[model samples]
Target: MTANSQMVTIKGTRDGLTLRLNDQCSFDSILEELYDKLSVNGVDDGQPMIRVTIQLGKRYLTMDQKEMLKRIIREKQKLVVEHIESDVITKEEAFAWKENSEITPIVRTIRSGQLIEVKGDLLLLGDVNPGGKVIATGNIFIIGHLRGIAHAGFDGNEEAVISASYMKPNQLRIAGQLSRAPDQDAEGVYIECGFIDKQDDAIRISPLQDVLKQKPDLVSFERRMLNG
Candidate 1:
């Protein structure tokens, strides 16, 4: 998750000190850096209360992660936890965020704690376990079971879709909208596809074959992303 390209920028403004983390970097890395940078020079009798505006680029932090970050600052360094901001953008991968020309594939199962982000379509050759996550700017096609978090259209592409042989994903997100698996059993649904319904402004799921038939020319996903 720590890449050489992960750029961190800091700036001071009237609002406060803004630590801008590259959207491509993982949350863990950002948090570690935050602790290292802020804790190095400050901390006087638990009373500095420096105002910090943390900006998350294109990613949402889990409640636990947020709490932990606040704890590190508020308790460890005695700094007041100020506003947390995120520049939520429609995205692809951090490195390939600007391009719309690639199709990424995973040859094996995405295990627990593994996170994947891609610029174009994603083809998973294996199952996605419960703790795994797949986020793409385009579409997601799962050859096996999809039992984890799958986010499509991270770049706000309304035409992006998600499909799987067995669609039991923990959660599904397209653009800014998100939905979770229903509480009921999914044994009856063998194959499924999820797509954004631009007219209704919602993500809809249907039988895979039926969805394909509706867009017979969609076999080439890159073409669709470019043309549709």
Candidate 2:
């Protein structure tokens, strides 16, 4: 391929324009080619502002480099940056992503006054006795009873959910919403899940099976378990 083509690939999309930078090329080469290409065919002042999406495939750019890229594009006047995409991430970002995506499993029962917290999803193999508390930034799954306070999405993730085999929690909290188990006989309680009801923005309890319909991403956790 030509040097110009190898450095930067530009295409017109339905939304606007897409600029794909070659990951294998040096940043200087990319900048030179990109400047040349844009200078030759930059948008006209009379034309409407066009949204531009930059795709840096497997290429990592520093904040200054990103700003330079945006500045180069902005010089065209009629080109507005919609967003930037990249496949590469820093080690800290990778670690944070892993922490948020992975599920933490605990096999101990939480007694009264105990508190268990996890940065991500929590999978407890035992029960949470009354006065105990369980918290997770993501979803919470209890294989046994949950008679204590259970809070999922404690960091304000309204989409988080809490599920328990025996769903008689003293308090259920998803994000900022909170609800207490209804005052009823706990004789025939089965698997139950608690989530924030979008309609009312309140905590709602339903059969655990309903979670499949509400949050399909839960399937990924099941897949991880099966694969492991």
Candidate 3:
């Protein structure tokens, strides 16, 4: 007979083991079950340690829960343990962290003549007023309207890109490439500009006639300094 604490189903597979827990069961109980189960099956069947996948319900786990899981893993394996979700930062928090990444997002508005420099990608959720400037070593993104100057890939990342909700700008620069906004079509309701292949290295800024392009390959930004 199983312990009367909580209900947990364990299924052994060729690859590893999967543990499914009921919503009614607390995570502590599930941890107890895991410790019990793994204790019986030590990593010595000419077989490696059984990889365990916990099935957490719809509830969002707290940091404490995540720490507990990490502790368990570290105990089983004497080596350093790393968790996948530990580095996942939201777009807002990411702005402070992206100076060292291949790409980063600022996610904040910039006032006029404000000189902002980033080592990686930059993202802004609000508008960038005239005279304000944004420079990055990587890509740049303005989710809202952009009226100031924006420079991306400052470190010579030619593949970098710059995007904005309303893409009208006084000037745009990417790597060594630069372009100015055209006289006509100054305000037709849409605007976008980015580097395209071929001889069109110009910063193409125009009203977006079609749906705004989506960027999925964007990577997370890392911080150079740590704050408590």
Candidate 4:
């Protein structure tokens, strides 16, 4: 019914209080309404501290504005700001997300001492010789032997995977987890995939066929073959 009420809606939940700020109103207006509401609903010194979650729907706030909002909530003393949520993101963030979601393809043999890095999923058509290293923010798929090191999800994406035709990498890493390949008498005949097990957070190596069961999302048949 009141302007302040329309500007900021406060609701109580089992966890704490949720503050839904009207995105349509100006930030200054919202701040004024918030201050008034906090002042009117004075808290008693004996009362327990209340956790507050602020939701800004479709509203983007700068770093200074976010800090100001947090400071205002903290000054209330009785209200502890748990976190702030927003549907809007900066252009840089959006670009990074898009870049990280893409798949990069390369055709070259990574020799010893060579390091290849990619922001997104990597599709390599050549072998990784001993002492060679490859890193990617997403998944890594190698059509050739991986004898050195392959680090997928280099930016801490645990869901990333590494698959190679010859699964004899010296070291394999998925996010923060790392595993060393055991001594093998011969190279692998079939492609092998490595991923982090969700249960124990350990790296596991399995046949590429098992990847269909483990990570069904990675399997796709969208590409069609063309006869010349």
Candidate 5:
């Protein structure tokens, strides 16, 4: 009836016992609290230990205490099987979504030879110099400068975009097409430097002023792209 460590709550169920641990606490504390609950219940002498399973959000973690603790640390992982079929999404399902999902806004610039792989839209505040590469499955945004190279739609997403404050990059790739910086404009926001047409395979760099006049909503790129 009583919770231990004021961090985990233990309750007796009709089948056995249930232990609910806070998400912020480490796995070690959870295990120690669980063991204490077992000792207090006095189920070791004659009675069997409760058939315990951990429920984290929507997924159920069913394993021995030791293995369960290990899995708890890496709870964000998803597992996939080619043949197995089931209706209910297990921790394996949540894990799959996490693995396949896109990461958002890269706040820092990648150094030389550093490879950054993100799932969702990515944004960089600093510059990406030569030899640095950024590969994102979704849109790529740069606030400062871009001089190295960046690849968007890495996983074959065609509707991806690459934007930067200073768009003088050595190379850029979107979906299946690639482009380099033009020998022209060097000031102001450049939003028209991507592969425009599906065919003919050409990269065009245009001024954002003309596009802004036509589509006013699209001009608010920062408000829409950045989550916070």
Candidate 6:
């Protein structure tokens, strides 16, 4: 019910937030505005508040287009697409697709000067040496050492996570918050994760095992044998 550029209407639903896109505006612009709005709209800390349902009243959307829309909202806004009340897809089917969504994986060592960017979740199979960098819109999992820079939730999504077997990164960023690694002896380091805390508006790091206690599915790192 707004102008062409900002035609996306947002409302709260019983399940989560619901959005209605203006048919007159192009989907691309509508989605961009959606991302901007979610970033501005605050989410209560320590709550699973990012699930969203989209209502495309009377609009005929193709399966591909619908999936693209869902992915955009999920990755850019760090929300889950629980439903899309459109002409084509069923509610049950949509939820199942989300569960079956496959994350993108980069199976290689990130050496100096190398940069990798991923749309959804990213899986790094090897070490991130000095001068290397990795950016992802979703969670970033490093099966080996992370000595360089790694940014999870490259977009404005705050619930993203960054975890590694040996978390010794030079710099770490999640969404908009940034922080540097502490000067700790390498031997003292263990599996660690970086995330935005609900209690405070700051980025914090803790033992990955401790993180797993609360959010078990947050990190899924399959350890790989490393050389000294």
| lDDT leader | 2
Question: What's the candidate order when arranged by decreasing lDDT?
Answer: 2, 4, 6, 1, 3, 5
Residue-by-residue lDDT tens digits, candidate 1, 107-216? 99998899989887888889999999999988888888889999988988767788988888889998888877656666753778888666777777888788888766
Mark the regions of model 4 whose C-alpha exceeds 4 Å error after superposition.
Answer: 2-20, 29-55, 70-85, 182-188, 208-228
Give model 6's TM-score versus the native structure: 0.54
Off by over 4 Å in 6: 1-101, 216-228
Flag the better candidate by lDDT, 3 or 4: 4
lDDT of each: 0.76, 0.89, 0.63, 0.87, 0.61, 0.78
- Candidate with top TM-score is 4
TM-score against native, each model:
0.51, 0.66, 0.45, 0.70, 0.48, 0.54
What digit string (tens of lDDT, one per residue) describes model 2 on residues 1-228?
Answer: 675657888899999999999998799998998898888995667889999999999999998999999999888547888889999899999999788877899999999999999998899999999999999999999999999999999889998999998899999999888899877755665788998888887888888888779889888878867775
lDDT of 4 by residue, 85-194 (tens): 99999989999987887777899999999999999889899999999999999999999999999999999999899998888898999999999876764454688899
* Tens-digit per-residue lDDT, 1-228, candidate 5: 334435567565775544455656665676676556444544333544334434443223344643655443223222111121223466776785555453465677777898887876676778888889988876677777778888887787665667777788889888777889888767665544343344555544455565345335444455654644
User: Backbone collision count in every prediction?
Assistant: 3, 0, 11, 0, 7, 0
Badly placed stretches (over 4 Å) of model 3 are 1-99, 102-107, 186-191, 206-228
RMSD of each: 13.9, 4.7, 11.6, 5.1, 14.9, 12.2
Expressed as tens digits, the lDDT of each residue in 47-96 for candidate 3 is: 54445665555434677876786577557643233322322455655864
Question: What is the TM-score ranking, best to worst?
Answer: 4, 2, 6, 1, 5, 3
In candidate 6, list every pair of residues with a backbone clash.
none
